[model samples]
Target: MEDFKFTISKFLKRTALVLVFLLAVLFVFAPSFSLAQVNTGIEFGAYTGLAQTDVRIIIAKIIRVFFGVLGIIAVGFTLYGGYMYMTSEGNEKKLETAKAILKNMAIGLAIILSALAIVQFVLNTLLNEYQAGPTGETTPPIGGETVCADCGFLGSVIESHYPGRGAMGIPRNTKIVITFKYDILAGSLIQDSNNNGQFGDTLGGGNNDRPSAAFKIYPTTGGESAAMAPNQFDVFLSVDKRTFIFKPKVLLGSALQDTNYTVKLTDAVKLADGSSAFGAIGAYSWGFTVSTVADLTPPQIESIIPTPSLDKYARNIMVQINFNEPVDPLSASGFFELASGDPTKNFQNINLAIDEGTKPLISGNFKITNQYRTVEFKTADECGHNPCGQTIYCLPGDKQILATVKSASVDSSNKPQAQITANFYDGVVDMAGNSLNGGGELRINGQNKIVLEPGVKTLNQWQAASGKILDDFSWRFLTSAILDTTAPKLTVITPGSLAEKIDVAAPLNMAFDKPMAIGSFKEIVLKTNKDFNINYTYFGTSYDALGQKVILPTQKAVRTTAEIAHGDFWQKSPTAPADTESAIYYPFAPSLLNDIYQNCFYPAVLQNSPRCVVGDISESNKLNDNTPSCFDLQNTNYEGYCSMGEPCPLVPAPHNP
Candidate 1:
């Protein structure tokens, strides 16, 4: 401890001696350089040294140089102190010594800066007082030379007025005014050699100062810009020749909303002394977007699936979404909210995206397709089937699922593109980087539960139709596929197929186990078993299976229709044999008949469903029961309620649907 204290004391003594030496040097030169020059007027800048026009400038420069040398020394000490601190490790003595060195360096720098600032202030204040007189504070000195950074020895723009850079909501009648660093060559521009009061020079070829133009404005929308008619705007120079202006003879009508414009000071513009306006330097241009009206156009959500339009849905459904415009994909990770319809819970009852339960997520990745306008989310089941190793099928729990899309997922721009609750990651955005409104929803796949009873079951095909793997596009029953192959039953026939003394006037009628489809009866031909020919005209509305009942004329009244009545004989042809045994064949095509369910009519005594076993109608099984009902034409019963043995109940009427 004694040795450490000795070392610190010796270092302090050395630092004190150095400071005293520097102070002595400054004091020695202080007399030669007047310290009280508060009233002395000086104009030369601190840009030069030695024998300059201004004594104050020389002193300021020398002081600055001295301070610069100290700054370098301080920097060196700082670096060394930092190295000592780091290398000291756990040595308290060395670490403390390094810290002290750094502190002293900082304090020295502050003192040097304060002294320099004091000198500059005093000099400037004295100059101002001398130039402006006692109280009229004079302005600061500006650039006197024509020089630029981009182009050597070139002048630049210093000021402007009206329709300036980034100026918005400009009035249509407003004109452009610009101030350059140097006075422009108006003599060459307007060709004032004749000294005429009016300007009619071909040198200023275009109104926008074409060829060697002075100033021009263009539309930033990348198309044909709005233009004023010729002679509508005139360009001229101010009296001092430093300012240029474009004056309009007529009104501009209205400025475009959300449109930008670019203004440029071409390089062709020359200075008053015949030098380049920018000293042969570069052109200067600036642009800004403006609006005559407030920008209120926001991004919109084009569509979403599992939408309200879908009345029912199944498990393993993906969430599909669409936007009216393109949006940032990275910010779309926040488009999420999953909950149940139980009303008591927020997200507990739902398991979306595989096993992603009620736990709220901080991030999500989305796949954008359909021209980058569509968003799709694959469920666990969907992903699993496609080898993505995720399953997202719905499990039995709440009947309804409630999902929502945050606005931040859509609008990822700097400002709110719309008045929405959601922001960049949670909402939507347009290609213009406009954010979408916040309020949005992610709906449930279905409203009610679909009971899965025994036998074959099939899920809807539309939901699985999208995505990379293209899942069979349909779901199947856990067991096997079941189908109904039972053909329709022909229960009863009206006119017997073989009747000896048949009433020919009685139109034919048939009944099926299920109501036979309309327009079933096909062909009816007349034949005789006798050796002579039988040419009886067989005509009677063709035994309509779907029409008004044909009522035969009363026995006493004259038969008006040309139909074969009772006791009618067959008409024999002239060249026919003595007896042609002709039989009336009512050939029926059972294949053309069908039931309401599209099952073709099958002719059998009794056939039960499932196995569709044919059985007898005695006590074993009854085929004439109402289990398979039909329309009774004889009783004029429109409703197909004619069960063979029982009275036809008030069944609904049947049409050819």
Candidate 2:
């Protein structure tokens, strides 16, 4: 029995000694570990995985467990000292040993109590204005002072959150995990000091007045947020009690697949001894995308017109973007960047979070058409310094007709340059709910660059890699300053109006001197002598340049009374207008016609048209009126008063009279 007792005593003494050593080690290493980086301040955690916020919480938990062991050791010391006092039984040396043990314990207890009292008093005095909490817990500082994210209240500390700030593509069925940091507050997020061992029905939620709101997850514009529901999501604590998982009965069934879900950690959830996730740094909130199908594939820029190069491009060039698939329009807006210099080197990965305030260098609106697969941005505007945020306004006769990539590295001529960068960065998602890999980039010579040399002597060029879908297919082009004002003219017409027998089934085809505006051509009317109007329609027009005044049959086709089947059109009855002397052209509005430069059109005589025939006199009379008289003056006398190849001027006038 004595041996067994002595062995037990020895074990106790060793455990106590080891606990003291651990405390010493912790004190020495604390500063380094406590110097934790603030990871929750950002939005992207997938690249870095398993958030750094989790890291800090885990470290805190290990320390808490170690300190808990220390408390057990302290209790052991008190019991051991009592046992020795009972066994001493008036023995001088044994009594002295008992006295020493008791004295040590008393001194330790005194120190612990004094520290607690001083800490409480100082904190209360410093933060006296704050209203006491529901459970007499230490509330946040009274007046809106900055809340410390790392501070503990009473003796407990907990600070962890999820969807990890700006995390994206979170599965709709995944759970919301919040590290509780301690097991004492198991089924709740509040202190349980007075309850001893019993769990409570209600836990305190800080300022929001709703306990379940100590943490919440809601769609950006829907779900319980629109109509409040109590305790819709059930909370579960991990076996170790360091992590809290929130699970909705069903998966997020929000209105759409790309619904935004934000998880907010309110200051209401307190630890067992009473402290919220850093007492008043507002609410710790982070958002993530809720997608039904897991979209791991990234989106890429399929094509961009006026590619990155030193090739000449029109100043009024229409910027077009083609994606592999349709993307959310908002995701692709405000990310198109334009600059005069090499913005290539300074491009940044745009944050897709909606609240990110990064604005485009130029101002413009995006138009999505072609079934939403293409985005068009018109960059034309009035001449002004900084119009559309340009550093210099475009003016006529500028030496560099087009805007060119200019850098301090290049000297002399500021050759024409243009650069276009398109980003669908704000979580642009395809129909499949797959997000564009924000990783897509435009690289120039191992760097993100879209610099164009003025194509003065040679064309400078670059091509983005094709490995990933999100990679940008961006480019630079030399610019042109020329304005187009020449009007489009009809150079030829089929089915000559003077023909004796015109094929009633043949469609009248009019060719233009240039690629005439399709809208302008609609103004051309075919009318009979009876004035019955011929109705015709065309598909949308285009802006391709032209030279030889000949419109392809594909370019212009008239709707004959009997029409032939063609693109976006079918045949009409040839007898509909009733055959007559001719069809006259009257309603062609040149002023409404414009070239690619938005230049207005001017009227010109159509070489010939079935639509109109200008009035004219008899052919012989017209010829005589235009012909010059065949009379000449002779320099020398010749036979019969006329010389070969000389004018018989006097005789001719006398004969005419």
For model 1, the superposed segments whose C-alpha errors exceed 4 Å read 1-160, 164-168, 179-183, 187-212, 220-233, 236-244, 248-260, 285-657
Global lDDT of each candidate: 0.37, 0.36
Compared with the true structure, model 1 gives a TM-score of 0.21
Q: Give all candidate RMSDs, comma-separated.
A: 46.7, 41.6
Which tens-of-lDDT digit does each residue in 93-174 have in candidate 1? Answer: 8998888877776776666566556555543432221111121112221132111132111111333233544556644434
TM-score of each: 0.21, 0.25
Model 2 stretches astray by more than 4 angstroms: 1-303, 323-327, 333-360, 384-470, 484-596, 599-657
**Top TM-score: which candidate number?**
2
1-657 in candidate 2: lDDT tens per residue? Answer: 345345545654665565456556555654543332122222123222444233333444564465456456656777887898899889877776666666666665554454444433432222222221221112342223212232222112322333443456665644455543354345344223334442221122311112254566677566546532424543433333444545454566443666677665566655566555445553444456776653334344444443444344445444455466544333343222344344222222221111114523333334443323445554424443211111222222212222111111111132111111122122344433343432323323335344322211111211222333322222333456654334344454444323222333345554444433232233333322211222222222222243221121112111111111111111112222211112222122223433323333322234232211111212331112122111122223322211111122222121100
